[model samples]
Target: MSARFEELDWQPTDLGEISLRRRRDPSSGADVYEVKLDDDFLMSSLFTEGEVALARLGLAAASGDPLDVVVGGLGLGWTAEAAFQDPRVRSLLVVEALEPVIGWHERGLVPASARLVPDTRCRLVHGDFFALAEDPRGFDPDSAHRRFHAVLLDIDHSPRHVLRPGNAALYEPAGLRRLARHLHPGGVFALWSDDPPDERFLSALGEVFQDAEAHTVRFDNPVLGGTSANTVYTARTPQP
Candidate 1:
């Protein structure tokens, strides 16, 4: 029997009306959880290869034993959950702009949320990622001096495309520098892009970091009956 479609949560935020729903994928006959912001589909459990890869590839860049990480988006908690899979991760702070999205995870409305809440390594922080990145104090308000091993971001679709006007600066030269301040030397900065590898963005990243590259994560899209791909832009801070 196929799972029936239903809306699980809904709320209004500074951005727009956001919602979460669960439904059966007609083509694959599998239950899928999805989050939508306004009219745009933000994320879907059915296709989360890129989200998972954002964490995996980002963590790979870190050379330290105990890793401190920050994930900039909490759509469905898949990325944060994947971060925990690496036993080397000592602490993970997920910074989310939307309150409802964080609430969904705390309420156990999302599958990955169940795993994230019980894990002592993880904590969700409700705040503007851009603001925090630009601030000299950084993401962790409690510990202003704390630096992360990696900063995995998946909030915006890509550098060329953003949900808000303020976010455009985040991919620019000045904004990239502000973000780099939060990372330790040789730390990783990875971002998930819906579009394929963007050379222009990588060039921008290279200007700020020591080494920058894009990893293309391909996965089957049951709805499209073909393979689709997303880009994970990984960059490493300079070593002192």
Candidate 2:
């Protein structure tokens, strides 16, 4: 099912005065989500179109039949679950910065994340994504992460998302350039953003990689008559 429902069950809070809401679901359980601006929940147990598209683009870029995927951020497992559905996915590594988010999923609070966590091919890297990105030499060649044919990142709202100041580097020209070096030829780097991105991010992407494309996608919302909008930044690695 599409991730359309927002938890009206939540109460208001201040993430140091940023004004946030925590989504509640007994089935998924409490502390499952955090919403910025109170009007929208940032992450949930349900999946969204942006996350699904991240998976689809990743799968399409793989030159090989079965693909190894490295997913940055494991919010509610929507992106991971969507990408894992492809038979071409040989392994999926979900990197999450928040331990509590992982705990919530492990406790069976979120259905999508909970389902994929138990898969044999699934591995959880319990740390910040940058740490993984910086230490490419530290990676084992045969490991699931090192062998990835695709890297899908859904860590923030978009290049514009800055829940943490450090996250901004993920979209910088230098950071994107680093990602290009990590992927196999013809591999794809799919990014999910909460809203349409600024030209700066797009231009930076163009500077770093080849065949860059941005897709504006929307997900149907029963709560909202129209739809929620977001952008997908997809770039290709050169094939040898």
Candidate 3:
């Protein structure tokens, strides 16, 4: 019953109040962890195929070996952890806007916390993804102008549906151009969308990168019945 649910953690963020909770997922009849931004659900441990796909698809599409990666959001740590599955991934940098979300991982409060904290190849950077992308200094403040072989993002729900107003620019032309500057030649950019592939967004990516495609990741949605799907949009930078 819902009465058995527990709020694991809660903190106020610049975007909103973020909360982590453990509750019964009626569809699966199991307890699942959930992350919420104020009243809106941000991520759930119940469905993570798409999140994992973001890292897998991106790294696979990249052109080089011993890849360096940057993940835009650290939502339950699924995407970041997934990146490590590839032996080619030499290093991983996760940039999260909310400090509380990072704290959840550091304190071993999230599902993927154990894997992330002990992984020497993985590092968590507390900063705004959008700002870091736009900055000439790149994602890491100490290491300026660093470029990665793959950049995977799972922040906003979609290009049109953003978590915050400033995030909207990230999907625009200028923003995309700035982001591209942070990638190695023929590097990969992958994004996870809760919605199906947006043709317009795909077209925009096509214009910015060399090859672009939207891969559909489907999974059983016990609560909704039948099945549900998310989109992983991947593109590669131009080769030098």
Candidate 4:
């Protein structure tokens, strides 16, 4: 079957080199978006539900303390925008590798993402999220510290759609260890992925962290443009 086909009732979006197609299921009509990079359907936006839930986890977990956050993968800016809503978040550091994806936001491809997550306390950096997530150079404990209350990541298609070829390393034990190392005590590290399978992911988390858990949540496809369920990886960091 072809990657993208016309649907009678759906919303279509054109953002430079990417195209977003959305449709809802008939029964519940859950929302999902299909992201077409160039001509290929890359990932689905229905996964945003998990992303949102993960963001909420960060918001609640980091509420009491002033939060310094790191968000990987700025897809449609949904998670970043959500995190920005929380007053507890004092600073937000967003890292995305793809320039075209970033351009889509700057060009106002998506409404919420059209540079509208205005908190003035944000730093948008273009680089590999894994590298930034563990940069000792960026973290200065003496002066203005670089501590994170939460690290939310949405790279690759939730481990199932590993299209980028480079994202696999981020899920390995080394990557998780680095993520845990930089996280603040009681800080949250969440990952959103496609489907609930692959025990390897769970094991990878266990190998690096103290407590690891996975949550199954149904989300909208944004690509198929309908409702579907996926998994969210949630882990906690040790406290000093």
The number of clashing residue pairs in each candidate reads 0, 2, 0, 13
TM-score, per-candidate, Cα-based: 0.97, 0.79, 0.96, 0.74
lDDT of 3 at 10: 92
How many Å off is the CA of 157 in candidate 2? 1.3
Error of 4 at 97 (Å): 0.8
* Local accuracy of candidate 4 as per-residue lDDT tens digits, 1-36: 222333212223332255555555455555445667
Best by lDDT: 1
| Candidate 2 error regions (>4 Å) | 1-40, 45-47, 138-145
- Superposed by TM-score, candidate 2 places the C-alpha of residue 181 at a distance from the truth, in angstroms, of 2.1
Q: Please tell me which model should have the higher lDDT, number 2 or number 4.
A: 2
Residue 3, model 3, lDDT:
45
Ranking by lDDT: 1, 3, 2, 4
Each prediction's RMSD over C-alphas, in Å, is 1.3, 5.5, 1.8, 6.4
Candidate-wise lDDT, in order:
0.91, 0.70, 0.90, 0.67
- TM-score between model 1 and native: 0.97
Between the candidate structures 2 and 3, which one is better when assessed by TM-score? 3
For 8-90, candidate 1 gives per-residue lDDT tens digits of 99898999999999998776677899999889898999888999999999998887989999999889988999998999999
lDDT of 4 at 143: 29
For model 4 the local lDDT of residue 189 reads 81
lDDT score, candidate 1, position 94: 94
| Candidate 3, RMSD to the unseen true structure | 1.8
Model 4 alpha-carbon drift over 4 Å, by segment: 1-34, 43-47, 62-64, 114-117, 138-145, 220-227
Per-residue error at 235 for model 1, in Å? 0.8
Report the number of the highest-TM-score candidate: 1
Clashing pairs in 3: none
